[model samples]
Target: MARTYHVYIMSNRHRTVLYIGVTGNLAHRVHAHQDGTGSAFTRRYNVTDLIYAEPYADVDEALRREKQLKRWTRAKKLGLIRRQNPTLQTIQGPYG
Candidate 1:
């Protein structure tokens, strides 16, 4: 079976911060973020809400998209998220 790659976005409750990341295991990564074990930036910003995620068959594609999103302005990033989540509320993680 082929492994999947994901480009994911996380945010704090107040939507005051955004974090973009690429991971081979979305569920594990999300768990880490929620538990404050993901990264210094995420833990420091209190960005634990899983907001958006996109899967890719290719790791390169996922990495490239992650890099692209990280470079975007906050407005642009929010626009992308709004396209899928108009209400901009916290989204359930991919896994239960």
Candidate 2:
């Protein structure tokens, strides 16, 4: 199978801590976070909940989206997250 890439967001329970990241293996990446091995920010702030994600054909596009998300203001990013994830629920495990 071909490897897939994704740009994703992780947020805290209150949807306060937002984390933007890119990964070639979404499941493994999310699992790492779930296992407390993802990133310092996530571990420190308990940002292990997957809030949103967008898949891309390649790393370039994924990186572009990741950067864009990072640049968005907190409110704007929250709007985006709410649009895609109305209930602010975790994605319930990684998907392709």
C-alpha lDDT of all candidate models, in order? 0.90, 0.87
TM-score of each: 0.94, 0.92
Query: Which residue pairs in model 1 clash with each other?
Result: none
Model 1: per-residue lDDT, tens digit, 1-96?
A: 999988988999999999999999989998999898999999999999888888899999999999999999999999999998887788875542
RMSD each, Å: 1.4, 1.2
- The runs of at least 3 residues in candidate 2 whose Cα sits more than 4 Å from the true structure, single-residue gaps closed, are none
Task: Give the per-residue lDDT of model 2 (tens digit) for 1-96.
Answer: 666789999888887788899999888998888778998888888888888888888888889889988999999998888899998899986387
Root-mean-square deviation of Cα positions for candidate 1 versus the true structure, in angstroms: 1.4
Q: Model 1, poorest ten-residue lDDT window?
A: 87-96
Clashing pairs in 2: none
Deviation in Å, model 2, residue 23 alpha carbon: 0.2
